[model samples]
Target: MAFSGGFGVTAAQGATNPNNDFQVANPPNDGISSLSWSPTANFLVSTSWDCEVYCYDVQANGQAVPKASIKHDKPALCSAWMHDGSAVFSGGCDNMVKKWDLATNTPTQIAAHDLPIRHLAWIPEVGLLVTGSWDKTLKYWDARQPTPTLQVQLPERCYALSCTHPLLVVGCAERHLQIFNLSNPQTPYRSIQSPLKYQTRCVATFPDKSGYLIGSIEGRVAVNHVEDSLASKNFTFKCHREQADIYAVNSISFHPRHGTFVTTGSDGVFNFWDKDSKQRLKQMQKCNAPIPCGAFNRDGSIFAYAVSYDWSKGGQDPMASAQGGNNIFLHATEETEVKPRPPANRVGGRR
Candidate 1:
């Protein structure tokens, strides 16, 4: 509530103290890197630059503190929960991907990369875990096997990744956008240049699997369709920019049931948009710091976003120490909050 420059009423569940809603496991010494909610339970997992992963029980009374913490030798950059929610998988700067069993709280190292593992996505239907690394490679692991099932060299160092069923999308260095059919990893089904003029920061697929949204450091988003015939529908737009500075678009997540999606940025704002209509539905409360990541629950009833200091903030006016601190925002996703309506056209109007 302290940050300025946002419109509309607050959309967070706990507005009085939004930071308290995250229920951090403990005060971390460094910025938070990633966050993922359990697919079934009201639990959440987070990675931090402090080289630790904290899992919290959000349903607990009072602030949902971390129920467990898993330490890593290097800064943990990304994490993903298995489809059944039985365990968690994390990757970090140490170039290791580890699987932690929630029942026993024991971590088992699974795979290793030459460089930092920057992104992870699990496809339950295919029983595969895909990891993208700064080493310029994409590795696929089968749950039943200990070694990677496939490894494909990328055009450049990987920066962002997203997957939905049969399709996998990766954004790498120098504006390379690569799309692969999960059934065949050796060849890419679609390869294109990102529309944005800067480094790709994040990517998320549409709920319907038609295309994906790509975010960049220049505060712009590019909408891409999978089919060559639908290429005409693709477009790019600028968002998350301030009056005097351009902020990086940090994360983009699509709602589970609705096709609408939300975007977060270094500008400290989370905005909901109907990609089909290309209109922003609502602008959520400002966090007063960069939002590193965001996610929606399996049922799309709850949305979570992480607010923390970003490397991009270095060398600017000194921020209040607390302002640079980390917290998660658990916001409610209601029909009134995200569903597009009214002059925006009828529900089935878009074709």
Candidate 2:
């Protein structure tokens, strides 16, 4: 990766130790709401409650250099990158979706919502930008058009959404799950209730595109298969919990190459899990604050995570301000960290 300016590293950036995982140089001032890595490169864009969307160029050596930043009228809640990485789309409490042209550093309003936009995903297969909002609607934008090409009224306010080619899974308020077969995007393919009891926090599709994972505020994750015949394969597991204390599973991200995944939580910790083996692969030490969001790079070689307030207590917690402010960390992933365990090593030896 090529960078034009010199980057400076602060003392806090060295706190995590550079050998394994280290802090990025400059992070947002307030809580991070979402993270998205470019589909084509090491470029990363993060949306924050500070009303800004920050971009960074992650170098080959794990050094992240600030590339640019754009502001919203209110807290920027979510962001998605264009398929070619030429631009970024972000939405926030301002109820407006803006596409930022990375080349010119200009932003254009492309869509709007009646309530806060909670999630954004770029569908390369259908060439549409999907936006989920608390207004109980899902809007598909063409980027070149002034209005949404299609608007589908959801059963409830959307909480989390994930798309993998033909499949799009949406988690909404009241534990509703709407599965969309993008091949027929006009209506719901299947509607069901979430397996977990509590509110949904995050959702991510499997790299193989056969199933998806759902994380809940109750510190549980459910592995779900799309086909009705595979219902026996669906299961839920517990994580990010200690004795007498349970933390919300804030984010779930799958490794692009291995199909194994990671879950970050409000417990200030992250763990790797293999759904096939039904085993916990690895767990990292707890950070100073909650891990609100995380994402794997294009090749799954680098894992980036945010250590900040997640609003789990319903309001701003003083913990983030006391713990050196919001920070982002990059972990150099190893084969053992994310790769699925051998069949012989798995429990029951069924795989």
lDDT of each: 0.79, 0.87
* Model 2 accuracy (lDDT, Cα): 0.87
TM-score each candidate.
0.89, 0.93
**Residue range 222-339, candidate 2, lDDT tens digits:** 9899889998988888888888799999999999999999999998898988888788888888877788999988888778899888899777576745556788877778788899
The worst-scoring run of ten residues by lDDT in candidate 1 lies at 1-10
Worst 10 residues of 2 by lDDT: 342-351
Best by TM-score: 2
Instruction: Write down the RMSD of all candidates, one decimal each.
Output: 5.3, 3.5
Error of 2 at 300 (Å): 0.5
Error of 1 at 90 (Å): 0.4
In model 1, state the lDDT of residue 269.
84
* Best candidate according to lDDT: 2
Each prediction's total of clashing residue pairs, residues at least 3 apart in sequence or on different chains, is: 1, 0
